[model samples]
Target: MGRVAVTGGTGTLGRTAVCALRAAGHDVVVMSRRTAPGLATADLLTGAGVEAAFTGADVVLHLATSRGTADRWQTQTVVDAVRETGGTARVVYTSIVGVDKVPSSYYRTKLRCEDLLHASGLRCAVVRVTQFHEFLGDFFASQRFSPVLLTPDVPVQPVHVRDAAAALVRVVSDDAVGRLPDVAGPQVLDGRTAARAYRDARGWHRPVLPVRLPGRAFRAYGAGHLCSPDAAVVDGVTFSGWLREQLGSAALT
Candidate 1:
């Protein structure tokens, strides 16, 4: 049981990670930008309170992420805080699979962050995972208002966030190993099929239309750059199974 500081501890994956760490008897310190009881306020985006949050931590689980261009800054700030604290805490970072291959700005920042962590001269481990089931759900939900759900033609293997969180905790508990095996869901399907599955799960009868995404990013996805079939460590929960649980009997096959 080590004293661990988890940045973005209140977020989707971070919440599950913090729970798992605490359940395993680790002294957990939650670091976020918001001030709340039992949680430390550390703005990774601004470098405020980071030193105090990471003080005396054995491991720093860096999980903060952004969808915009500020992603790299957030990660660099974490690295700076770790160096500034003068502590020997191992940094465990959660990343997405295929960041190196994807052409998106967010993914590129993630790749840069990986490089930053490697050159920081600290004990570090990076665990890359596929998109989460919840992320897909949200994505589909956002486009539901249209007459038809316009889905991308790319393939996706959506891992359960809880499973990803568990893998992260395991890495944190072990010796720091750089760039661990990629974690993914047990099944892979094209966006149309995935969207159909989600639609059925929610009992939404809207038709799902497959639309081709343009540019190098879409090409990379179409080329299966987002998938790591051989290197993927499969999690037990399939997207269908998780949807069934969430929607109860309403979820279809």
Candidate 2:
């Protein structure tokens, strides 16, 4: 195991990845904007102190993200720091599944980051992942005060961040040279079905309405581009199981 610097190390997936890497016996350093006892302050937005943080790192986990195309600049900063430091660290970038398919500005930014790494002339790997379990959970929670739960009239294969983090560890540990297979959940659930299940779990009895929003991105989502056909479903907790674990099994349908 070698030194690994994780950008956005305090984030949801970042925290899990850092733990997995450390448990795998790799030396890990967390890089964030705020300075902490064990974290190296490296703001990817401004490229501040990134070189020093990436120095001597065997692999750099690029987990930092931003809204819209700001991710493009952030990824460029990481690449530039790696080059400026004269380090040959393999960068493991965490990307979203269907970055190439979705027409959303955020997905475009993700694809741009991928392109930047491929063109940066550095050893890098890209792993696309499906929506996290928390993502769906948050959606239901957002509708807590609503009279009806508005679910998207589309299917989604959501994965647990813990499993995604574990896959990320494997990518970093192995010969990560290029784009790897997509990671996804074990099962795919429709909008209304998933919403009903989520409603039961939260003990919030409400009418679940599956609505279709008009947008290119929403249409892309409805087309199942987010759920890649070649995705490797990880053997981990499912969405319903995760809900039970979080909200208890008593409130389930």
lDDT (Cα, 0-100) at 17 in candidate 2: 90
Q: What is the lDDT of residue 237 in candidate 2?
A: 73
lDDT of 2 by residue, 1-253 (tens): 8889999899989999999999999999899899779889888888888999999998999998889667899999999999987849999999998899889888888999999998889999999999998998898898889999999998888898888998888888887688888889887778888898888887786899999999898998898887864675656778888888898764333
- TM-scores for every predicted model: 0.94, 0.96
Q: Estimate the Cα RMSD of every predicted model relative to the unseen true structure.
A: 1.6, 1.4
Which ranges of candidate 2 are over 4 A from the true structure? 250-253
For candidate 2, give the lDDT of residue 19. 94
- Tell me how far the alpha carbon of residue 141 in candidate 2 is from the true structure, in angstroms, after superposition: 0.2
Per-residue lDDT for 34-98 in model 1, tens only? Answer: 88898898888778899998889989999988877677788888788888888488999888889
The lDDT values for all models are 0.84, 0.88
Q: Which 10 residues in a row give candidate 1 its minimum summed lDDT?
A: 227-236
